[model samples]
Target: MTLPADITERLARLALPSQAVIDGAHVDALSGETFDNVSPRDGQLLNKVAACQKEDVALAVFAARTAFEDGRWRDQGPRAKKAVLFRLAELMERDADELALLESLDVGKPISDARNVDIPLAINTCRWYAEALDKVYGEVGASPVDRLSYAVHEPLGVIGAIVPWNFPLHMAMWKVAPALAMGNSVVLKPAEESPLTALKLGALALEAGLPAGVLNVVPGFGAVTGEALALSMDVDMIAFTGSGPVGRKLMEYSARSNLKRISLELGGKSPQIVFADCPDLEAAAQAAAWGVFYNQGEVCTAASRLLVEASIKEAFVERVAEVAKGMKVGDPLDPSTQFGAMVSERQMNTALGYIAIAGSQGARRVLGGGQVLKETGGFYVEPTIFDRLQPSHALAREEVFGPVLGVMSFTTEDEAIALANDTVYGLAAGLWTSDVNRALRGARRLKAGLVWVNGWDACDITMPFGGFKQSGFGRDRSLHALHKYADLKSVSVTLR
Candidate 1:
């Protein structure tokens, strides 16, 4: 299909730097290995990035260790760190549009979303953690006679972060911001599918006054570079955002080594519950559509499971169907597009396979059961909806991580709560109701870490974000996230 005028302009305007930056120098991979970044929209080659390897990961970790031990970054006080972070936020804001375009091209998310939602939130995350660094308080205890006792927070040096492809830049910021704010250096490995923006951010961080070797970005395959980072004995902590199986492996590797401090934010199949008494059915329907379809429904907190009260199930399903039907799925750079292509050909095939499974399992297809606008050559799946699904159905239990929703009905409050908690993953859940008592009960009873009342997928930088159960542990945002990168030590001194 012909590209839209706006998309064409944006694509032509994007300028990718020729080399990857490492240790204050722009360089190529050690083996001269390279990988092509393809746009999901038309399978077009966007750019060629250095294909980093295990040796590269080791180099990155060593650089970070040196930065933490011998570099100026570790010697800077909390106030100085905050100032550097603030400057980083400013630089991010300045390059927002360019980064947004890169993110949209690399990940197949709408340019508008990359600009207005993802990039801004990422910058604000750094700014928020910057302000909180100096405010984190430690404990002081009463001592025995002629003794003084106090506690201090210290950084866990040389953190290793592995981020997924769906929101590459944003997830990188989520990991890097707090770790740097707490005085720890980082070695970041971006998913191979979407690594351009992360590499760009590495350069931008240097421009923002972050010292060289303090932050390193390596783009490579998971089995090679990613595994090396997780298994490295020199790395102090491992913070990862990815699938459950990989998270389990990371845990095992950490255990085998130094039992490194690990923080994982994994997959989810979150539920969006709509009660009969919801005051605004239209608003709930729209929120549900956006929650499930945004970024091609690749979000960890995507409301893939919709649990509606029996009385309102029919109407709510119809309303959501209407909204889904109206969404525009095409080129991501188009300003008018609401949805975009899936991240890659592999993800497209995976989503289609899930749809087939849903069909064979006897879930009724309410709307959008197939691909749309195939002439574009883009890996685009229709916004799909499956209704009358059983609680044990594969579609209901697993995270499709695509633009697909499974609808189920519940009779009572207990049933709704049970259905919501039925999944192994519990990253987030949404509750829409007019009754205050029911809302309160749902909020308390839901097993997920984040609960939205009368809305879905609405997040702020100040709120804590993580999951329970197989969805992984440890939070990402908020002041509490800073604690994940820090260690507490208590000291007692005798003064006679």
Candidate 2:
């Protein structure tokens, strides 16, 4: 696994964003405090990042409010806002390689994925929203003959956007792009584990000619900076992507403050079902195996649960296990590496702990078990798969958020749907079958926000992304996402 010379050179001179970006400028925390940003890849010191606390959040919120109220951005002509967003997208494209490297290093994800998927998608998302800014139209409602009624979409000002470590810049853009496109000011709080990309994005937004105080970046732990942003009375909305506990806390914080609108994209323990009549067994096997192992299974919609028909259970698991065994688990910076380190040693331990609990809960390990590549000082785990587990098993119910897959067999379509919907999460699910009737029926019966008939994660940015039930609410992609950052105002004019 040779590192690219370009990547090597960039790594040698990596300059991390060590301060929060507020009012379109980089600044230290009001308390001048900082924390170590250690690389999970090798436990090396990446940099010392500013630890923004309550006061820093207050400053960011005030800045955002001022920008929103004064119409610095909110009152911009649609085309003007579009031009700035388009410029930001162009800048992201210009620095694509650098952004990819930052994400790969910060999140311990494969460089190939960062370069090919995350950063590119983030840039596309920005461009997509920029192109959409001038295209969105309001509606005219029918009213009595004496009056004319129309509804207009207004920007929800002062958004507190909190993104997770797994996707980092991608998730931030999911919120920021839409919020900014709608002419709202934003205070972005990147996950403490991964903040470099968000800070850089803020800088790029300013470089793209966005007004000062339109977008602010605060990097720190969730307890202080995140909570402060969530509890800010001035903030109009909170668009968050993370865990259920944190989402609930955000709601509570909103309740305690301004009753700000909360849009949550909590992680999910999704399922992938395979019937014996699958169109392509090999493809299904690949989907089941890689879907769970990709990004070290850090994805919120990871298909961690694989439901196979009873008749094909044994053979399918073998096929999936072979795919899992072939995964190249190594340094994320290496081009050929498919599986990378966990975001931190703590996350690695969490996966290991879940594996231990799965063993105790009567699940038989089919492939992979413990940590690997320990000599490299990185937190790498083998792609693990477990079968012979009941739906009641803890591994089957919980989100391990690691390179671990649990297998179960269902004799009937009814049972498969039942098992798939048993979890508290309803983010995404998939099924493979040649029978269109069963596929359609199962898709309808399955409880999830997004469902794929013959593939895993088959959709793109054009589709709405989010979850149902306890997995949380609020769509994050497509034209629907812009609605999250807007308010509907109805007006009626009486005819003379």
Give the winner by TM-score. 2
Model 2 scores a TM of 0.99
Q: Model 1 scores what on Cα lDDT? A: 0.89
TM-score of each: 0.97, 0.99
Candidate 2: list runs displaced more than 4 Å.
none
Q: For residue 346, what is the lDDT in candidate 1?
A: 90
Encode model 1's per-residue lDDT on 97-197: one tens digit a residue.
Answer: 88998888888898889999889988988898898888888898987878889999889999999999899888998999999988999998899888888
lDDT of every predicted structure (CA atoms): 0.89, 0.93
Clash list (residue pairs), candidate 2: none
Query: What is residue 496's positional error in candidate 2, in angstroms?
Result: 3.0
Q: Candidate 2 overall Cα lDDT vs. reference?
A: 0.93
lDDT by residue for model 2 (1-496), tens:
3688987999888778889999878999999999999887888889999999999999999999999999999999988998999999999999988999899889899999999999999999999999988777898988999999999999988999999999999999999999999999999999999999999999899999999999999999999999999888899999999999999999999999999999999979899999999999999999998889999999999999999999999999999999988889889999888999999999999999999999999899999989988887888889999999888898998889999999999999898999999999999999999999998898899899999989999988899999999999999999999988999999999999
Reference-based TM-score, model 1? 0.97
